[model samples]
Target: MYSSIELENVEPRELEEEAPTLLSVGRELKPEKMRPNVWHYERGEENAYHRQGEQEELYVVLEGTVDVTIERDDERDVITLSKHDVLVVPPESWRQLRAVEESRVLAVGAPNVPDDGMLEE
Candidate 1:
């Protein structure tokens, strides 16, 4: 059996308090090995600084622009991504994303472990 659903049809999930709108694509699609999410950010909205224990994530900017900050070993790097831009982040690297404008992003991560993420203060 196969399943198909349009992105616009899925309801947003309240995964983060006071954060961007999140659509859980993997939850709707039910893929076995990966988790995918679509995030809609208003201007100045941002996610928290966090890292995953075993999941490597790929983020693609679907609309507008965002600034992704990555931290590793006391060093931090900020990367600006526009539409169609992609960023790959390693499992242990902490990352945060802030919207430069109203934007949409597609984030896919492997292994799909729900409890493997850690947030920084």
Candidate 2:
């Protein structure tokens, strides 16, 4: 069996006014091993810094640009991604994404574990 959806047809999740619009593609598709989400961010908006306990995540820039800040141990790095760029983040790396322009990104996490994320202040 297979599932398909046009991204524009997916409903966006209701979140804080400052938060990016989120579309849960995996929720709609009912994937067993992966969670896929799409994020629509306005320029200058950002997500919280957070890390997963056991699920690695992949981020793909689908439109515009974003800066991904990753912190591990005591070190930090920022990587800029334009359309079509991709980044794979390990489970324990603290990371956040800021929109450099109005942007859309696809994030997918493997193993589809519940409550695997811990957000930082």
For each candidate, what TM-score against the reference?
Answer: 0.94, 0.95
Cα lDDT of model 2 by residue, 1-121, tens digit: 9999999999999576437989989889989899999999999989988999999999999999999999999899999999999999999999999999999999999989885988875
Score candidate 1 by lDDT: 0.92
Q: Give Cα-based local distance difference scores for all models.
A: 0.92, 0.92
Q: Which regions of candidate 2 fall more than 4 Å away from where they truly are?
A: none
lDDT of 2: 0.92
Q: lDDT at 68 for candidate 1?
A: 97
lDDT of 1 by residue, 63-93 (tens): 9999999999999999999999999999999
How good is model 1 by TM-score?
0.94
**Candidate 2 positional error at 49, Å:** 0.6
Candidate number of the best lDDT: 2
